[model samples]
Target chain A: EAGVAQSPRYKIIEKRQSVAFWCNPISGHATLYWYQQILGQGPKLLIQFQNNGVVDDSQLPKDRFSAERLKGVDSTLKIQPAKLEDSAVYLCASSPGTSGEQFFGPGTRLTVL
Target chain B: DQQVKQNSPSLSVQEGRISILNCDYTNSMFDYFLWYKKYPAEGPTFLISISSIKDKNEDGRFTVFLNKSAKHLSLHIVPSQPGDSAVYFCASRYPGTYKYIFGTGTRLKVLA
Candidate 1:
């Protein structure tokens, strides 16, 4: 079976610019998550969605970062007025349920200048 | 503060030898732990996992041991192979919570 899919394997933007990343999860998966991974660090959970409803987003930067899972199949994460510190790999993952094992996508590597 | 910690930055072991990767967590609430393997330019893949209630779980050559008292866990790969070379991350989650805390990761090199 095909795994999770993400767009724009890599991206580069200037500070204060707005950028967005897309993710398409595995078929029939019910849960989706977005994570940020800085260099030499593990992926940090940013947000999670069960179907079209958000399950958790406590770590999300409300001032600049936002994400949506419209139909429960595909999702997007956006960072407005991006900062140099925001440059990192944005990963998308999916699982069958809340406590299920997750399958990850290739991730979008963002570099902010 | 990082809840999960992998103190070792890297580990090197000869092929056919044993590789032990260690991890510790500060949160006593974490009840489930997992290990993930990642390669350069690729996302992490689930390796093995052990729940807090179990002391050890084994799968083929991979084994995970959990010590709830010490809030520590370790992954053991016996008769290691070159294919096992990769970055390994330790992750944990509290019961009934959707979020998982992960360690910084340890790069393991299995020499031939």
Candidate 2:
């Protein structure tokens, strides 16, 4: 079976610019999540979507980061006015249910100058 | 506060030896424990998992032991190989939830 897919394996942007990453989860998966992994650190959950509805986004930075999942199949995460601190990898993951091992995508590495 | 912790940042073991990586979690509600292995430039892949009720689970050369009383879990790799070199992370989730709290990771290098 195919795993989660993400677009633009790498990206570079200047500070204060806007950038977005896309994710397409595996077929029939019901839950999707976005996480940010800084160098030398574990992935930090940014947001979660159960179908087309959100499950949790408490850790998301509301001021500049936003995400959405359309029709529960594909999702996008955007960072507006990105900062240098935002330079990291954005990973997209999916699981068949509310409880299982999450399948991860290759991730998009964003480098902000 | 950090919910999960992996105190060892790195380890080196000779091939065919045993390699043990440790993790500690502060949340008592976590019922599922998992370990993931990651290679540079690649996303992490699931290695193994164990339920809270079980004190030990083994698959092939990998074994995971959970000590609820100490809130500690460990991953053991036996007969380690150079191919096993990579960063390993431990994660846990409470029952009925998919959101897992992950550790910082421990890098293991198996020297041939």
Candidate 3:
């Protein structure tokens, strides 16, 4: 079976610019998640979506970061006015449901200048 | 606070030897533990998992041991191969929580 899919495996943008990442989860998967992984650190959960509704986003940067899963199949994460500290890989993952094992995508490596 | 931690930043072992990686978690509520392996430029792949009730779980050459009393878990790779060289991450999740807390990760290098 195909795994989770993400678009634009790599991205580069200037500070204060807006950048967006897209994710298409595995077929029939009911849960999707977005994570940020800085160098030398583990991936940190940014947001989670169960179907079309959000399950958790307490860690998300409400001032500049936002995500949505309109149809429950595909999702997008956006960062407006990106900062240099935002330079990291954005990973997308999916699972059958809550508490299930997750399958990850290739991830989008964002470099902010 | 850091919920999970992998103290070793890196480890090198000769091929055909045993490689042991350790992880410690501060949370007692976590009921599930998992190990993931990741190669450079690639996302992490699930390797093995153990529930709280089990003290040990093994698959192929990989074995995971959990010590609830010490709040410690470890991943053991026997007859380590060069292909096994990758970053290893330990994760834990509580029974009812959907989130999984991950460690900083430990990089293992198998020298041939």
Q: Report model 1's TM-score to 2 decimal places.
A: 0.98
TM-score for all models, in order of appearance? 0.98, 0.98, 0.98
Q: Give candidate 3 regions above 4 Å deviation.
A: none
For model 2 chain A, give the 10-residue run with minimal summed lDDT. A95-104
| lDDT of model 3, residue A68 | 97
**iRMS for model 3?**
0.8
DockQ of 3: 0.79
Residues A1-113 of candidate 2 have per-residue lDDT tens digits of 99889988999999999999999999999999999999988889999999999999999998999999998899999999899999999999999884569889989999999
Cα lDDT, all candidates: 0.93, 0.94, 0.94
Q: Please write out the lDDT profile of model 3 over residues B1-112, one tens digit for every residue.
A: 8999999999999999999999999999999999999998888999999999999999999999999999999999998999999999999986776688889999999999
Q: How well does chain B match by TM-score in each candidate?
A: 0.98, 0.98, 0.98
Docking class of 1: medium
Error of 2 at B98 (Å): 0.9
Which tens-of-lDDT digit does each residue in A1-113 have in candidate 1? 99999988999999999999999999999999999999999999999999999999999999999999998899999999999999999999999884547899989999999
Cα lDDT of model 3 by residue, A1-113, tens digit: 99999988999999999999999999999889999999999999999898989989999998999999988899999999899999999999999975548899989999999
Each prediction's DockQ?
Answer: 0.79, 0.75, 0.79
Structural RMSD, model 3: 0.9
